[model samples]
Target chain A: MNKLPDALPVEKAAISDLARQTLHGTVDEATNARGRERMISAARAGASKSNGTQRRRRITRASVLLFAAAALAVSLVIWWPRAPLTFVTTGGEVTSTHDGGVRVATRDAESVTRFSDGSVVTFGVQSAGRLEGVRTNGARVVLTSGELHLDITHRKDTAWSIEAGPYVVRVTGTAFDVAWSPSEGAFVVAMRQGSVVVEGPLTPAGVSLRAGQHLVVARDGVMRMGEGTPPTLAELAVASSDAVALVSSAAPVVVSRAPSAPAEAPPSSSVPAIATSVAPSDRPASFAKLVAEGRYAQVVTAARGRGLEWVAESASLEELVALADAARYEKDGTLARAALEAERKRFATTQAGRNATFLLGRLAEDSDGNTARAIVLYDEYLQTGGPFSAEALGRKMLAVRKTRGDAGAEPIARAYLEKYPKGVYAAAARSIVGTP
Target chain B: MPLTVAARKVVPVVRWQTPAELVQALLAAEPEAHGVLWDRYSTSLRAVLRRSLGPDTEVEDALQEVFIRFFRALPTLREPAALGSFLFGIAVHVARGLLRKRRIRRWFRLTDDGEIPEPPDDVDPVSEQAQAAVRRLYVILDDLDDESRLVFVLRHIEGLEITELAACLKMSPATVKRRLARVTPLVFARARNDADLASFMAAPDQGERS
Candidate 1:
């Protein structure tokens, strides 16, 4: 960690908290206002005394001696080490300093130092460059030296972006730092705000960065996005597989597992247009249309054609069977059972298929009240690398509990808590287990 | 020429002092001079303080300290109109000092009666939970250092200006600009993470049989 200069002992946490408290009305106003009034008045009076004499003297003494003497005094004052510059902020004060650093303080607010190699920094309240708002959205400082500091207050849902060097920082509304090192020929972006995506170099295209995350771009344009612990092998594997599965299920067809092929394959032609237009209201209408038209063959064909693929829509196997039965006016229990078994088999083979199976299981529970069968389907969906692993486990626990009462719920919840401590629905499981 | 010289001689040396100079004089035992000085720059100073301290804090207390400190350090000040900057500086110090004291008290869990409890250094279950919470919070705040955070809070939260901030802190305007550049994104990252967390938690479960 980099240590700040000793003169600047104020912690950022303390400052932020103070700012928050002051904004929230926890600080007193009347007394501070009066005190400020007195201080400024005194300073101005003194200024008039010093500058006033020079003005009056100039008027009286057109004489060379007095004129020369006045000019000399002015020069001396300007050259003086302690010559003060007027600092102002609408509601805060400039506080602390570091080598090549400064702050602007005003009542209830302060603007700290931002770096600029050769660029200018600008600030305005509310609207960008609209100095009228009581509070500023964020300050924009142009970087000339390839580095600038921007500390902004978080406005709900409002984001501030910084364009520095070859990078653009999309802020989520918190305080963070960005530095562009000309010597290194790369920009280093750090979050002070919530988080930011340091997009630049256009090499690998867009990159998303989170809080406590930093990235370094080499002069050769190689960008590595971490300084501390790099992504673990397990994490990378999970992310890769999840991405592949999610894309395969959402897209029309499952692209081959070819290493040379791009992660996102071109859309497949066989995937029906219905998958593309899978909206909430459209789900029931499409299902009804399929049933009315006796399109069981087409539904099964479509489902089979997109083998080992995930469909984000509600056109699962169970929904197809319901549509077929509604159209044919016949309930074939053997066919229904066969279709479900086939769906389960397909789901077990791939992550996307598993997600589809889970969706089908959920549809069955909703439409057919087959709780026992749904529980079995959910268990298969919870296998390793299952797309709905967390959801499947949660539903299984709920199903068992409902059938066997509270006694059965506790053990399932405990088992879930033990297996996946940070799993989705872990909190609910913990609640069931009576643990915090 | 003679009349001009006479006028110059009679003008009683025309001792004009800058606001800063008058402030210094008032602080240096000339309490009587303080009133005149106060009458001149009180409103401007108050505006600066109100903006700096924000409308939320006891602005009056901070303002009072500005005056007291102004008086106490008047002798050391060489420039007078820089009085605005000087007073602004004093205000910043006072605010930071108060905040530091508050943080220290909170960190130590100090009691109102001035008793300090033993700092919890052990990693017990309760402490571990607390540490985890603290860790998460810091993970949110860690992207920023102290200076960047202050700059962010003062400008964005308190809404201060480059010129005023530069004057108060006795720094160049450029420095404030650079600091702000670095601080904005850190704030944004934390907010984004929060939204993501909320969405993830709200996702519907597929296994739920209702």
Candidate 2:
């Protein structure tokens, strides 16, 4: 009854080969043995319902031992210690590492501790803190005295926090500066990019600080919270010796504290900014190469230096696409839009150019918050029959819902569900349609 | 010199030649038939599960579930000669259930430790490029619906024939073809668009049907 040809067409065969090579692999003998044992035990247990008590007893005996083994394995996995942070001190002395805790005291120069996830902590001269714990996702730091600068990398499920005296600053991936004096009971936190929550005395409920915000509590229980100016590139260069290049991409922020203003310096001097349009460039010949090397910040800086519009006009199609990617990564929406528009203008008929409309739609919805414009772009992209059609439709539906309410989005949701019943947004569409 | 019948001694060995015979033996509670069934199809089923699940550590558990389910449903299997297809149907069902569970877990912000599949040491290590392609492919698949994802993997990765795919997915051959036609080009286009997988996938123009 198999009437179709055995040989897949050349293209299909090639894809078939690629997928096969990419995915298929051998299951090890040990896993196979374990599976076989489990299968037999489970099957026997099921069969023992009809069989005599002897088989039931045998199954029970085997199951108990299996349960014990599984328990031990799970315990071992749970209690395993994550790898510690590898660090380097620049011309300073640090305490000997014990277990997972290390006291860091910078005497003559600053010390930098780097996490595996690309987060960096730089302790300024005369600063002291102990590494309370380090997990795969984050670390717990206790700042006893002096200043501590954190350029924590943002990642999914990151959990890093800083404790000073009675105050604790919870961080979910952001660059910030914090200073604490145990004797004086003074604490300061300055946010550069992402948001953070600070919990401490007086206001025990915790205060949330966004980018460019600052918080300070004095030794005498006086607190002053206000807007802070981000520091200039020149100030950051003078503040930390070698970290200038690392943090140059950030625009510095400064906040003032009343009681500790004279005794302690503002934490803004060490704040690491996320995306300063101005940064040092490696002068790569192509933006794609820079992106491949993971230097997104530099790509934006170089693109901006060349004039975003100029780069969009003169750069190669590939380079323009790469520039857009870099700008997107750097959270520079204007540059990203410019680059994408350039692709649509120059290589209008090319595959990359056609895909640009979808990316532009995403940018419009996410960064620009132009939901109506986003829907238009999504419609345009969908009409092109591009590869991202499903995603575009999904985004357009959401944008419609945002603008015209759920009732307005229902038709689009129905169309989306019809076209892509198992698409990424299927569940959301189902909810919109009130389907189970 | 040839030995005469009087001087020759023979030992006899018995084996089940067909899946129907194997099924009958299994139904008769012959213990050895279970091993025979596993020995016949486990490797193929394991590879299918591996592709569908994407290097998850729960593959072994899923594999056991397939066998146990197959055993329980053996009597209900109308076409006992089509045992491989029945087993595959169960495997896909189990993989879909696991994917649904994973989605729910993600919604609840729970980490799936079972999702991290252990690297195989027995096989020669894959090149970094191939590994990247694998990751990119799976990420794209994750965006598709469960049925489309399974169909793509079963048809393309597992190299199942259209008939076999229809049997496994419990869809008509026409429906299978339609779904494949819709999804295959889109997936290939996306793969071609991706930087890492672009080199691995055939160029769109080169592979396009004239």
- What TM-score does chain B get in every candidate? 0.50, 0.79
Per-model DockQ against the true two-chain complex: 0.04, 0.14
Candidate 2 C-alpha lDDT tens digits along B1-210:
000111111212156658788789888877666666666666667667778877533477778878877876776889887777777788888888888887787777664663544556654455665666767887788888788888888877776778888877889998888787778777777877888777666543343221
Writing each residue's lDDT as its tens digit, candidate 1 over B53-116 gives 3332335555556676666566678876566566656766776565555456656876423665
Tell me the spans in candidate 2 whose CA falls farther than 4 Å from its real position. Answer: A1-12, A49-436, B1-14, B114-123, B203-210
Cα lDDT tens digits, model 1, A287-393, are: 54543343343343343443323322334644543333332222333343444444445444543345546655665565578888778778766654332455568
Q: How high is the CA lDDT of each candidate model?
A: 0.46, 0.68
State each candidate's clash count. 144, 8
Pick by lDDT: which candidate is best?
2
Q: State candidate 1's TM-score.
A: 0.23
Chain B TM-score of candidate number 1: 0.50
Per-residue lDDT of A130-153 in model 2, one digit per residue for the tens? 776677778888776778889888
- Model 1 regions more than 4 Å off: A1-436, B1-21, B24-32, B36-59, B110-146, B157-178, B188-210
lDDT of 2 at A290: 53
